[model samples]
Target: MADVAAKERRILVAVDEGDESMHALSWCLSNLISENSKDALLLLYVKPPRAVYSTLDGTGYLFSSDIMAAMDRHGYDVAESVLEKAKRMCKDLHDVKVESIIEDGDPRDVICQMTQRLGVDVLVMGSRGYGLIKRAFLGSVSNHCAQNVKCPVLIVKKPKSTVANN
Candidate 1:
């Protein structure tokens, strides 16, 4: 059989601190991406807008210096940990290229933009599998990306058993 993936496929998987996103990454590793010479997997982690807005924006209120510093530290720590864990997961898959991308913005928008910019063959991500009410209240990143991205979107939902354990 011909090695179809050798044609240079770029698969982008959006990940975060959530277990669901990690599961999606794992799924992509084991199912979609393979040890094809020209294929690449891009793991993207988007840090949402900070809890506190800058005083430069003209807002009279300002977050305390200590609190703001803590927020910065936490964001960096989480990003590094997640990316490292993701990289470790893919280390054994020889011949499959892996890249980590960390961005700061609304994930829904960032994921869509990066997907097109990277010319991704497919955007793989996880769905929180929220009910209609929950999704309506919080919105769904995977759902939004599926609608907006130019590339195909693959949303891997958490298994029922896994969800139950959490």
Candidate 2:
């Protein structure tokens, strides 16, 4: 078991437009903190790649078309909203600092790249996400990330909902 007295470790949490992301963020904020003091958290939101390609004539590539651009903007908006909620929850916790980043690409690749570039010590993310269709086709992002990143990855399963509500 890891010692609780260890120094603060950098944590990277992947966020997407989904309930799983929200649950993971909440769990990280509440559970992971510096033993000595506050620790920094980097939240990342990755947008799905757009359908664009290069021309056979070698003219240029068409990327981020009007529709894709709009979707990208929407993704940023969602990320910002999630960050705002996270900040609100952290108001009482002085030992945690949060930062948010939005990027566009394959989530697995982007997460691994960010982890390497940011020097992340731990990764906290949801085991399952809202991209069921994509997952069925492309495999789970968490799975790919777990296989690729060097650091330890924490995969949180969603809390089971009560049947009494129904």
Candidate 3:
């Protein structure tokens, strides 16, 4: 137990605006992280690349520089908000170090790259609970990372609240 606690580990938790990711972070803190251990909790938020709008396509209106700048700012703001929320969740963790990173790219690719680049011991992320058809069409980030990453991946599925029958 002492050896396990003494070993330093890096655990990456990919987050976004969705409640599922936040739920996964909370679950990771409760079940995987130890208060006394020298663990580094990394909160990663990936901003998708902005769509390229062209006047040649169909729309006569071209995207102005101001519009593009505003869009970029909005993306930055969202990343900050998500990271802040995640940091607040880790406020109680006195021993474990917490770090936040914001990267711009596709979530699936960025997440996989970060895990390997950071040499994470374990990857933690949320399951969106998409159905078979939806998952097939949209693709699953968790599923992709699980198959690609070398480290152990933990996909936390947020349980649906059950209502008691009267």
Indicate the worst ten consecutive residues by lDDT in candidate 3. 51-60
The numbered model that scores best in TM-score is 3
Assess each prediction's global lDDT (C-alpha) against the native: 0.76, 0.70, 0.81
- Taking the tens digit of each residue's C-alpha lDDT, what string does model 3 give over 1-166? 4566686899999988777888889889888887787899999998766642222224425667887788789889988998998899899888899999999876778999999999999999987622343345447878898999999999987777823111
Worst 10 residues of 2 by lDDT: 51-60
> lDDT value for candidate 1?
0.76
Candidate 2 ranges with C-alpha deviation above 4 Å: 1-6, 34-36, 52-68, 162-166
Ranking by lDDT: 3, 1, 2
The number of residue pairs in model 2 that clash at the backbone is 1
Give lDDT tens digits, candidate 2, residues 34-137: 43445777888776564311222143354447745675576667768866765665566565567777777777788899999999999989887536765554
Q: Which stretches of candidate 3 lie over 4 Å from their true place?
A: 1-3, 52-61, 129-138, 162-166
Candidate 1 stretches with Cα past 4 Å from truth are 52-62, 129-138, 163-166
Write candidate 1's Cα lDDT for 36-60 as tens digits: 6567889898876563224323452
Weakest ten-residue segment in model 1 by summed lDDT: 51-60
TM-score list, all predictions:
0.82, 0.77, 0.84
